[model samples]
Target chain A: MSAKLNATNTLRVTRIASVKTENQTTKTYTFKDARCAKAKPGQFLMLWIPQIDEIPLSIMNTEGNSVSVTVKAVGDATRHLHNMKQGETIGVRGPFGNHFTQNNGNVLLVGGGTGTAPLLFLAKQLATKTKRLSFIIGAKTKNELLFLNQLDPLCTEQPVAATEDGTYGLKCLATQPLETLLAEEGKEKFKMVYACGPEAMTRQVFNLTEKHGVQMEASLERLMRCGIGLCGSCMIGKYRVCKDGPVFNSQQLREVKDELGISKLGFDGNRIPL
Target chain B: MNSNPLSTRLAGLELRNPTALASGILGYSPESLQRIAEAGAGAVVTKSVGLTPRVGYPNPTVVQANCGIINAMGLPNPGIAEYASEIRYAKTVLTVPFIVSVYGYSAEEYAAVAKAAATAGADAVELNVSCPHVKETGSEIGQNPKLLTQVIRQVKAATSKPVIVKLSPNVTDIVEIAQAASAAGADALTAVNTVRAIAIDAETALPILSNTRGGLSGPAVKPIALRCVYDIYEKVKTPIIGCGGITTWKDAVEFILAGASAVQIGTALAQKNPAVFQTINRGITAYLKKKKYRSIKEIVGKAQRN
Candidate 1:
């Protein structure tokens, strides 16, 4: 492994280069680090806020030697991260875990909540390789839908949005339109379907893709401590979310079907319903 | 006939090879253990399970230093009650010996977890009285020979399966503890858990691991671990399972020569993946052929003899 890859296990200190407010609860922080900058879409970084806590965030974007992580102020670590200003130093460990496989042909992207972070990065990367690209984002409200402006320019088809309260393009769950899209487009029309969201949403999308016999890959979230494969916190069935994948394909999902959306490991390592 | 030169026996359990997966490294679930077993480990050990559920410390729990990795995971587990099902599942799929590493705050708790592990179908139980970072349980108990002996005796009485005690390198005299464990009915001993250590960040001026102090594992601790194995081997009749910083077949062979009946691999798994088992096994097999030894048993403690 190169030094950059080896740095995945070693923590590197970097100052926040820039910050962008994505929504009321979410902000994207950019930092100058070669190891993280080299991250492929669907991989994540373990960000450490000194004296506070370390949390895993999806790689939102990368520009040159700079990489960005989108954070939603859900827990203590993220709330602290939200209050920090630019130039504040934090520790980074990865660009760890596997990334989504980019394939040629028409593709569909489904994202919900902060899960859209990695999918947005994937969408941007897939723009050039795919002949036709479509994006679907869902959130509790219109303001919560992420990266509308950025995704619009790259998508070959008009992006779709679903708000639980019907405050946006569609008043249904993100998977609703995805079901229609996959049904109308037919399995042969779309080469692959990619999803990153709440486990339930991704699991729903997986079922849809399976019903249609289309290949799918979805990024999952679990209580993670060691971003490397060592910790079993991220284990889902036979796979460790940190190593085997934060992103898993159709076959991988099938193997973990019983636990995919129904249950996940809590911080205590006990199986708790998702 | 079992003619493989690498085959060895530890505590009456037959192992296809001398390499067993050390506890606390991807041994959480049955599937992960099965994955390691399929990758060619002679035996697989589970992460240390306690009497109750423990969330462990927060992130910054593990970091890679210049020579090795340091971690203070705070003994995370789903509790033995929940983990028993995983053990039951592991027994169904695993072809190699499955050992459950158990820990507790007291002798009764350790015995309780060991009994549960036995009921869950574990081939053996490795007492984890040696975790360096945890307070009041791990090294705290292991550092005291009296306490360590009490814990071992309780666990040994609770289960019929072979009991292996993992020793702490942080102690003043490992041989005393080794002897204590052997006297208390420990069938085997894993000489040396990670050396107690820590890392600090220059920029923040704070410890990198959430717990201020952790244990060090990798190539840096190999010499120290080998010394412990050698020292304990001289005084104790119990079989020794050498662990700490074993990265190559040479390292495994050195531990064997130093009197380790078998070896455990942990930190190296982070760098090498599961293939390290096959790599080390192959190297040991080649070395045995070159040295004209018919089996690994013949070479155990060869260096000690000299």
Candidate 2:
């Protein structure tokens, strides 16, 4: 007997409407889905590329009936996704994960590499709500710094741009500019620090936020399957990165901080040093 | 479909429906467990807790294959002492029966955890004898009938609550173990845990799970689980909680017909939210109405006589 029926988690085939090449290794693909347009900042969608296997992608930007996902061609699945042509079909499964907590007052937004995808969306949302906002964008080089042009108009002051090679704004890590910014203005200037990036950078952001006593929320990355919290692959300690957070407040981050940047469990459940 | 005929009894525990939150899937915390109950599970089982806190295996703890997921979480849980508060908190919020699933290296340790759970207001204690990932415990204990019996007896002696011995599917004859648990005074039996299995990366020429091996659960193991329940039904009289790859209401029905009094859902919850319990319950209720059965008990084991 055919057991096939409409189930909640079934992947819906969506047409890729457009694609934007962000940098050398990163590209953002836009797909037509009304559900995603309403998705909160920091929520992710599981994209299926047929035989390549399903993987979670953060909603980079959304407008009208289209949602965009910034893909970094690092793994086999992502490499295959990068090669796909626009208008070709793919499966979209979510808008999953707990979103960043939005509040009033100034907020420091930091992002590095492709991790800038969700933070860019958060910045856009917070720009309308917060009294002030500043962005700290980081990458290995200026070419890899993401979303600075888009973030420029939304910030009260110039967004801090940092690249390892000194090709852009600051000649240091993303957190370095924030360290100076926080020290100059004091912790009360920025109500919270929001970050998503390399684990090492996120760890640094966490430490700076803690030292300054400023609240912080960070998006964590892990190998995940079944993004709704069933598969335990995306867990850091007791928390499921996909469920408890893709974005975690400082308090939540502190609980699982022991396992955070120290190591990440591989797809085979082996600990890989971060 | 809504004459309220879905309520049923498993051994002595009353259930509003046959659907339960199976152990090891989203049972890590009381908040999550309470949420699952709010979503419509008849009962909830906590993740198996041992005597001491365990970090469990490193990642790739759970991996998806074509048919199901292979997880070697190694039964990671806070020790009973620490998890007791979670149990108490969960009990205060839960309207459904709270079944604490416990595991340990020895019968004495199992009894200690079960006692703590019972004191913390667990409606039942599910002795996790069949978890395939953990060594010297789980299936290692469950695969041996004598050891399984000792563990069950110890837990039973320690708690006034119902004792459900969860069985392993890796055994040559699950019936032998089931009968032994039944004779040893197990109030009920969760017919199967994940089957011992492995997944490998064809590209990397390596095993996919961090532990290299894990137990498989999902739509793939339903047939095996059904056969297990059917076999145990023929040889043992204890109420069976069939739990392997039961993803739909129809799958739940098949287990009931095979003599499972209730079904525990795990892997399916990964695909969807806790709402699957209510969806399955509604579907089961509709099926019962369509079949002209007044209650699920009327259909339980109906296919076995033939």
Candidate 3:
């Protein structure tokens, strides 16, 4: 159960143990990896799809000897991964970067799209520790709002849903309801606010956390070539998202305010506006 | 009477120590460079920048090997034009020397990138002609004495700052190439780059790295790199910056004794944190004290004398 096995920085081939469809563009692939299975929520693994490409994916859940990563078919590697069969094999390297700090008391989980995958894993772990856990899951439509059924039993209150097309609960962006949530709960009510989604949404959540003086931890995604921090593709300010973070606290977030949601390094190492 | 045992000069640029942050390792931006500088690297070299932006190769770019790490990053860069600002910003906060690593397909391109680097306020420009995986440039230009000479001369003429040529170890005769670079006016030479190597996944029956081939670095290449430094120092007059597989103070000392004026740290950073710089510097200082050497310069080529 030592996560150190996943931290070898070398490729280890593992066959897919199971696969679950999450949404239209996203699918959850489970593979048996003792090292990966022990990974703390918020940590990620670099999933290598043979000759196609090697990309970083969030650890969605770990049960028994298996670990799962929820991947959306957004790029070449992920698309290829979606087409992979249950018996197909892929290379993995990690459980890398830092993980979220589990805080007690009232906590809010905000997720957008496949970003909900990691949060769902976290919610399951935090269910027994926290006094109250509330989730705000957002997507373009009800079909895309992920992990609602999985989150139901774990959350003290029913998980809130927000869809842009009004096909679900709140007809607005994920962060739109955050202000009301933070205000209703009062500034001191929620001990920590954890979020993982698009940069824009994370940025809004960050701003809200700052305004309300609530502690926040967020997972950020970037073009990562080397999960060991050698490559500079995932850099934000001085922090390499692969090493210094994939999850960053409020203090660390403040240091990278300039590039957090504003810009990111592209595949060619050019800074592109987010 | 050098008051600091660790202080040394390489190609006319003053450094706090001899340990440098090698190119292609956390040197993509001014902030990362500044962070390493703050961590106590005597000098910092940026990831190689070219005339045009290059996305390099796809993933599976790096893998851990038996004794070292193999990488085929394909020379991904933001291009010198876009990276100039990063150099400019680094100059403002960095207290140590800042070297820009430049690469290109032709001599003219190398010169252009060096010129852009010079204009951007770089203290020196390290010619990255030794990268093994990329074609047309890197080892392609470095392996040939004539081509290497052309690159050195053009880059030397393009920039007033020191031009340090990084040589490929995969050559018929490294000494001849080092001599050629020296004759063409290279101010200093980085003795070696990653040795060309490959890793294959038995499960998939395919090469692990996207490029199929890559440059090997880390503890595995130290002996190879030390030999290059030792050989190049015997024939070349230019200062030698020993690179490849230098992880500890003992390793750094070995390079100095073999005639290296400085050493570059790359793969070691992957294993240890940036604090490795301070650790090495401390070890070097202690070694100097224990040996009763007044300055690290006295140890240069000490083994050669025997």
Candidate 4:
């Protein structure tokens, strides 16, 4: 609501390191924007070309202003955005929204599809701060799984990967490993939980963390136009998914209505309507 | 992007710059307007108000798909009496002039609201001649060039301050309406209101919007908005407040070059991160500084070297 705080006020192109495909529809952009390296967790920025439209992208991690955005070639803007190369200078607008809070105890991280990008950045932060951390990630099939191999080195135990097809880790759902880990380690093992993915899965992750009385924060997605509150396109329940969220802790999600497939979690930790 | 002072007279009101917040987005509440305008917008257009208070449509009132949004707000607004109070309230906060936007089914209604807005200390009155919700056959007063002329002229006659005529983009020929409006005493033109459209529920088999049809705006509609502004600017002498799908300063510059004296931000304002006028103005200033262009007037409509 305040004037846009520029996390990337002064930035220029670092270079496109490489591009990796995550599914027929999504691609991971590994580029360097010197401005993005200064961004904090939960903050996002606007990436755009001069003539093309501007679009908001959550900064994945910055190795000195050299940032990356994992994009899905869904439409003309993104399709064209993905085809660009390393040397091109795309404009950066933010490092916007609230950042994930830091905790020094045991933690759990989960994600699905390209939603992993933000959590991956959070994981990188957790890697240095937390005593023990575990991750659970999922994809529709093996091909959709991204960054898990990279995530392995950052955690105590490798991320428990899941795919709908038995092509990855548990061959069940990503939540399965969390419940197993909880049962074995006891509910009090982790002090906090962080997750991002589809509404259905984020809701499930919320329920589990809530039962353990563990604090959890999530990155939720909505149809956003302005990436600011003025457009009113990305409202969910009473809050603006663009302004108020895109990231919400368990306590914040409780205030939101469940209509958009995100009612409170069922007792067993599954999204009810879905 | 010329910086030689882009401020111009809209209905004789001096806009610090050429952009204004389009009607239907910013409400009469000064707090919201102040939050946005502080970012360096040219002006803020209060949401369209009328003789009677309107509650507007139900929730899910806004949604996004691909590059744009479909909104069927039904011009929900507080009646003039309450609206005037809010305008007075906002005036205390905003440094820029607050342009009042009002709509009605008939000429008398427009004039009455225009009078109320003037009494409320509104800087100017923008007569909304193009809301597509009138009767379905055509806009009640806006589509017919003669009726448009009559309505705008009456509104102008009613208000001492300048009167701007807002036109819909759905017409087979938009320029005709712009020309007619210009000739009828309109002081400025706000080109290209929403293009009427509808969404359907594949599951329930009903129109998605409660009002049955809504106006579409966003990145998808910029070209159409630009074309309308370009066409209207050439046909009329009135200043133009170009709107629709304008999210960046580059888009703003295009509207100016296409002959818009100023532009308004609609759906783009709803999202939180608008490097909008501040970023855009800076970008414009930089472009001007870089090119040694003297003023915005210098390059308006001067196409790039293709």
Q: What TM-score would each prediction reach against the true structure?
A: 0.97, 0.68, 0.97, 0.57
* Residue B231 shift from truth in candidate 4, angstroms: 1.4
Q: Which parts of model 1 have CA positions greater than 4 angstroms off?
A: A1-6, A185-188
What DockQ does each prediction reach against the true complex? 0.60, 0.13, 0.56, 0.06
lDDT of 4 by residue, B225-254 (tens): 999998876767777888888877788888
User: Model 1 chain B — which ten-residue stretch has the worst lDDT?
Assistant: B266-275
Best by DockQ: 1
TM-score head-to-head 2 vs 4, winner = 2
Q: Find the 10 residues in a row with the least total lDDT in model 2 chain A.
A: A1-10
**Deviation in Å, model 1, residue A219 alpha carbon:** 1.1
* Minimal lDDT window, size 10, model 1 chain A: A1-10
User: Candidate 1, after superposition: displacement of residue B5 in Å?
Assistant: 1.6
Q: Model 4, residue B186: what's the lDDT? A: 85
Which residue runs does candidate 4 get wrong by more than 4 Å? A1-274, B1-4, B134-138, B271-274, B303-306
In candidate 3 chain B, what residue range of length 10 has the lowest lDDT sum? B266-275
Q: Is candidate 2 or candidate 4 better by lDDT?
A: 2
Runs with alpha carbons beyond 4 Å of true place in candidate 3: A1-7, A185-188
Per-residue lDDT over A1-274 for candidate 4, one digit per residue giving the tens place of the 0 to 100 score:
1122222222232445767676677776766555566777776866654345456677677776467778877666788877777665455545656678877898888888877888888888889988888888888899888788779998987778999898867687777776777666544578778888777788777777777667888887764444545444344544556576778887777755354344422211112353
Superposed by TM-score, candidate 3 places the C-alpha of residue A224 at a distance from the truth, in angstroms, of 0.4
Residue-level lDDT of model 1, residues A75-109, one tens digit each, is: 88899999999999999888888999998798999
Give the per-residue lDDT digits (tens) of candidate 1, residues B26-81.
Answer: 85778888889888899999899999999899878988876777888999898998
lDDT of 2 by residue, A114-202 (tens): 99999999888888888889889999998999888899998888988999999988889998888988787534568889999999999
- Model 2, position A253: C-alpha lDDT score: 82
TM-score of 3: 0.97
In model 4, how large is the Cα lDDT of residue B242? 84
